[model samples]
Target: GAISYVSFGYINKSVQPISINGVQPTENNVKNNKWKIWSYEHIYTRGKPTGLTKKFLTYLKNDHIQTTLFNKLGYISV
Candidate 1:
């Protein structure tokens, strides 16, 4: 076997999200179930976090960060 090429994936305004059958992948389309190419994010651990991870997850879920940082970084809150 030999290496030929490499590939990477992107989300949101950073790069043009690929369209499915001429339907652009947008938040509205995803919400209405028109867009199907999407992935879910999850935090995993052997057990519950007891330190920085816990604090950071709390901050991530906070209203201020969810509205400001998440949107600014082109992430949709779920």
Candidate 2:
């Protein structure tokens, strides 16, 4: 058997059949198995964000945009 690390959304969209067997990196699963997860960070300089940075951050934080990212792009929001 082979194991592939992919997001839940991706699995749903895959043409080939995949089995989760109730295993996923949700909050509970990650807590129980810390080593099975990784994370991404957004780093910015001190002081209030300005210009394109502000706009980009705002766009990324929008509920609709976040929902699209999760649903269409297979991204797990933090």
Candidate 3:
């Protein structure tokens, strides 16, 4: 099963930013798990908590939990 991805919006500050890219087709040149990418601006995930640190923390937790579960279940190549 594919885990739900949580988006984070606005941290540094920018205008007319591009939407964040979701899952990728190829894993080539990917830097992190599930193929993370950098975007000009971010949009908050559905039901994402609003705030400065809490939102960031929530996303981090979600990512950590998802990856940890995957790795534990032998989802990783290694």
Candidate 4:
């Protein structure tokens, strides 16, 4: 097959500090987009890699990278 069409995805994410990972996002306040916290490159043709939204979060889950986030701030399933 050819190169195929590229895609763009985004998700809102709350960037916080991780005492374990030693990765503190640039902002103390949380943010949102359409992509997950990790494996952002897989979700977009081109877009921001941090502070994503729920839509992209679900997308990342489909790819099985949901729990693979390097700095998981944890999720609440309400």
By the lDDT metric, which is better: model 1 or model 2?
1
Mark the 10 consecutive residues where model 3 has the least summed lDDT: 8-17
Candidate 1 off by > 4 Å: 1-14
Model 4 scores worst on lDDT over the 10 consecutive residues at 2-11
Across residues 1-78, which tens digit of lDDT does each residue of candidate 2 receive? 556665444555343433256564554564466436445545685689898888988888889987677547656555
What are the per-model numbers of colliding residue pairs? 0, 0, 0, 15
Cα distance off (Å), candidate 3, residue 8: 26
Residue 69 CA displacement from its true place in model 2, Å: 2.7
User: Each prediction's TM-score against the native?
Assistant: 0.68, 0.49, 0.19, 0.17
Superposed by TM-score, candidate 3 places the C-alpha of residue 42 at a distance from the truth, in angstroms, of 25
What does candidate 1's lDDT look like per residue over 1-78, in tens digits? 332211122342444445669887776786688977666567886688878888988888999997787777656666
User: What lDDT score belongs to each candidate, Candidate 1 first?
Assistant: 0.66, 0.60, 0.43, 0.36
lDDT for 20 in candidate 2 is: 54
Tell me, by TM-score, which candidate is best: 1
Ranking by lDDT: 1, 2, 3, 4
- The digit string of per-residue lDDT tens for model 3 on 1-78 reads 223333232222432223346565232423354555533224455575568667665664586754775345423322
Question: Cα RMSD (Å) between model 4 and the true structure?
Answer: 15.7
TM-score: the better of candidates 1 and 3: 1
